[model samples]
Target: MIDSTISSFPLIGLVLLLGLAIGSFLNVVIHRIPRGESVVRPGSRCPACGHRVRPGDNIPVIGYLRLRGRCRDCGAAISRRYPLVEMLTGIIFVAIAIKSGLTIDAALEAIFASAMIALIFTDAREQLLPDVITCPLLLFTLLAAAWRGGWGEPVAYPFDLSLVFATESETGFPAMRAAIVGGLLIAAAVPSFWLIDRLDIFLFNKYHDWQTETDSTRQLTAEEETAIASYEHQDRRMKRLAMAIAIVSSLLWVTLALRLGNHDPLAWKGAWSGLTGAVTGALVGALPLWWLRTGYYLVRGVEGLGLGDVKLMAGIGAFLGWQGALCILLISSIAGSLVGLWMMRTSTARLATAIPFGCFLGSAALAMLLKQIIWLAA
Candidate 1:
């Protein structure tokens, strides 16, 4: 018989290499996905020169280094972000491979992580965390978790994933459990963070808006107030408009997923958990921020929820189901709070801050999903 061990080595190496290559492509997706642009179609081009990048010129980390982090056609300097994205993706890919071998879930996990990197950094640069990546992430995380299988019919040992992988040939329930648990964790986490923040805010300034005292957004200057009159009674309408985004997106995902899985209501419990976590998280993260936004508008042009975030959470809920999504929500909140505090304490002596809770929410959701995989054996 062909040597199973020898054959496996080549396969593993090939997967790792392909993952690195894919990581390079993910860099482009990261930049463009948030803009609502097609990941395919346009192909690669230099932002400065508008010159198409040839196959040879697109060689991942090597390409950036050889070109000295600049576009060869335009000779314009490129930000180090490109190389960093490639490297980060490569590392995450390799790590996931080590964790789960060449399973579909592993591949999806890598993609999920890559998407988060894009979402987190993009939001950091511009105050936006697009539904594009987050939506896909939640859907795939749930589907991948639910529609999963394994390698062999070997043994099932306690607290050992290797054995679980071998024995867990069937799909459905186990993955469902993982997704449910993870999403629930995220759901529980976010409100807990908000509760704590609420407590802190209530303790310090009970009547003041939770975020304004801490918001970094500058006060309206005399000229800006004049501009506000032009917008008029639109803020309330905008909030209502934002509601449509969440409603439509959630329905679409739920329908799409049900059609694909052909599952029953009970079968949906696990998948639904991811969605629950996302919605819960979105509310927890956005409520205070929304209050801040509305507060600024003085009852105009302000919303209780950023339609984008609300819709995005619905997508998250669809993918993660309920439980696992919750974990993501919670973990993200903790991270964001810590980071915002550090930034605030070090950078400015402001009384209030406008922390980007979406950044934390996204990250926590991803974390919760990942933990589900690791804890599956348990």
Candidate 2:
């Protein structure tokens, strides 16, 4: 047993190395997704000089150290974010591996961790959470929940609606009820997107432009113009993709619920429970924020939270369930408030200063996930 344990060390090391590579790719995602650029097509290049990064100079943390934090071609200083993300991801992957022991749960957890890290950095630097990450993440979490039985915390409904749907068989009620509940929640949430869009148009007279900049008076260079056009095109494409994903996911949920309602409930009980929990979690996670966003706009005539945040929370809910989602919201809100207070005290910026709330949310979500993993291990 001891020899076998010793041999496993190499596997853990490999996982760590793979994580570092994934982190490098995540850096590409963080940078390009926000800019409406393709993460796959363009190879790594010096942002300042547009020179392709040489093969030897692209080795994660070591490459950054070898380059001395400067581009080889133009000598422009490279952002330390590269090494930081790579190291962080490697550490997270190693920790997950050690705790979960190369299981499917560990893989799922690693994916969640990587997405959270990307969102945390992307929101911190760009104040944007691209749908390209959150939308797919939402779908992944729902599927993961169904696969894993549940997120550990089973959702508790306030009232017992099972009585109304109870049938002759003892097991029939649970599966049928869960299916009905999940379907209803999914159906309710679908129209929210259209409603939010309509609200934005009604209140603001236009869709909220995330790409709007303050430098409207400046003359744009030809390159800058090209970049902006590319960004806009990519943004549109991403939105369409997000819509497609949302539609397909919702339809799958409803279809599965219908099918599950007719089958033997015992066979798919775990899946039904998981699907119900995920749907409830998504609604609980997103609706309150939507309410706050709408109320704030009505009262103040300005947007308080971005729609990306609502979607981000929904993804968190799909993974962690309603209880975890609420915990994340509470923790992030407190942290954001404290940071805003500190900023107000230290800087000249006023109350209207835009704080990256998604950064706080992402950080809280990661911490909560680690905490849960540790608790389960203990």
Candidate 3:
């Protein structure tokens, strides 16, 4: 193991502090973004009373503890989630640093982990994954992959971007090329899936109408009847438009890459090969959910997987590569299934209740990343 040259506890402490600060900002994001409010323009305010949080009272976990977990002005009880998010981020940051040892990979992991935390809570609370976060995350991860070369092979100790640029052999083609490939693949894949979703919905509607006509045993409520009668896929045109854009973008990229040719013998020719793996991983991560969603709809005549989940998995593939995405699916499925079954038995949640699946995916992916770090340390 490379000596990080700092005492572990102190370093962890410092990072924990940073994480708490970042987590405080994340609390605002989770609250505001889903509601389509600006996360920046409006400072933290009491939800109950609309009193802007005083700076002294806004100190992450400490503020909550000092105030006895209530608003300083209004004295309304605050949710425990504020402190929990801060503490969870702190712990995740510490774990990543311990596993990665002050490396760039650790820093990148910390950022991604923070975003994942925000996504988890936002989805859990609202069942919405804001594109504001997920879209940027996807783009950033592709760049990170380019900068770090491929997954599994992070730049070594004495981390330097100059060296990253100087040593082309390490990164495969340049960072620019890898970014192009990763971006292109993501673009093409996401829209294709969107089109598939539109088609699936159309078919589901047709199937439902057929069943309604033929089967007398199934009784439809007034609300259900109205919903089916009014149901038209609202975003069909949007999906078609997106698919066209993606197709053009993908073809342009392939043409550009092919034109670039083999200029440098020392350049790692495997950049394309690496991207192929990423594309495969992304597809592997997304397709299973699509199959499950479509299959569930056929059986139950209700939408199971939201489009948010499909997009989230695609982003996961771009960031973690495909294998990590598969691991996320496995872990999340087990966790969600267990929780879902428990909810069915113990709560008002029925089999048809739409659980926030994106929450599970985000949480599971972050967990697997942490586990990866722990396994590396072990």
Candidate 4:
């Protein structure tokens, strides 16, 4: 058990400061990622003016306050979103720190909070869950799991030596092995995504018959028709190439995972458990959406969800485990359905209107995490 009460105000202040800084960075990610812009380069700039923002002007909430919510160079009104994101991040970080304390779990939770904030804002604004964020997050959680499980040295009570790829007592490289295995798993995502995409394309072709409207009123030139045919042929070849890459990557990952799993299964400790949990969580989280996507296409001949949603779920599952992942799915679906229904009733949206499902997932996952923390504390 831990106390949420801050015995020292300075510690609380430091945690809040850290949170604000992370939130500031997240704002950059939200703004740049969807635009396919580099978050690191070009630095922060006033949206209304081309002038680069000064370091003093980029100081999170304080910067906004000092600037009076207006750009110094152009005097253009800055969006309230910037300060809001910074505050939200700081609050979430402070909450997690209070709940989890300054341990590995606290660090992990903070990372999770940052990811959720980024995903929520990005999805809400652009309906995208960028791979740049989700892919790295998945890798971080997998490695964190191994570290927390005592991969190299015994640290905590929940230590499980069985999770290591090799016997910790014998090999003395348990943490290293876990790290390598985790890395391999992370690398596997690229191929897995390619395979999933290829399968989707195949299913689409098999289930749907397609013919472009002949502009039935206008006859196409011979060259134009030939160009269209050539494009279709090239597209088919590209899909085939993608499928081949997926296959090779799948085989490579499987070989690595199997080689790692050759150690005693019964001795599986916290590290191994974390790896299995992540893999299982990813499948559990992704399969439902995949099924839904396929079914929707089969019946409606339209994609009801984006592939980005699937990757987002897999990333969430990697951090939260299968049970938590399932919980997030259920909650997000319910929330999305309710909101969708309301939108339709209010004439704000149509059945075919795309909803940002990733936003719902991010929000729901954060809420669930808070609930879990509260429940455990009680």
Q: Could you tell me the C-alpha RMSD of candidate 4 in Å?
A: 8.1
Candidate 2 regions with alpha-carbon error over 4 angstroms: 1-7, 150-170, 173-195, 213-229, 239-264, 372-378
Model 4's alpha-carbon lDDT is 0.70
Off by over 4 Å in 1: 1-9, 34-36, 136-142, 145-307, 311-321, 349-354, 370-378
Error of 3 at 111 (Å): 2.1
Candidate 3 lDDT (Cα, 0 to 1):
0.67
lDDT (C-alpha, whole model) for all candidates? 0.51, 0.74, 0.67, 0.70
Q: Give per-residue CA lDDT, model 1, range 1-378, as digits (tens).
A: 111232365666676667667767777766665444456769888878889987777888788888888888888997787878777666556556656566655666676677666766666555555544444443443334333322221111122222232223334433443443443433343233335336534643443332232343878666545433332223333333443443454455444444544454334433433333334434443454445544654555333333344434544443444444445556655776688779787976653434555566566655554553346435
lDDT score at residue 27, model 3, on the 0-100 scale = 92
Higher-ranked by TM-score: 2 or 3 = 2
Quote the lDDT for 364 in model 3. Answer: 81
Which predicted model would earn the best lDDT? Answer: 2
Sort the candidates on TM-score, descending order.
Answer: 2, 4, 3, 1
Q: How would you encode candidate 2's per-residue C-alpha lDDT over 1-378 as one tens digit per residue? A: 011221377897898898999999999988888777899977999999999999899998999999999999999999999999999999888777765567677788899999999999998888788766776677677666665653333334332223344444656536445655655544444344556667778877877756554345677787767776887687667656755665676567666756754564554555555655676677788888878887897798777788878888988887887888889989988998999899999988676628888898888888777774556558
Instruction: Please provide, for model 3 over 1-378, each residue's C-alpha lDDT reduced to its tens digit, 9 standing for 90 to 100.
Output: 432544567777898898999999899988876555556777889999999988888998989999999998888999999999999998888777777777777788788898899999988886766555665565445445543543444322232222323446543455355446544664655355546556765877532232253355889788656544432232343345555655665565455445552454223334344445445555677778878877887798776776567667876765677778878998888888898898899887567645788888998888777775556668
Better of 2 and 4 by lDDT: 2
Q: How far out, in Å, is residue 49 in model 3?
A: 0.5
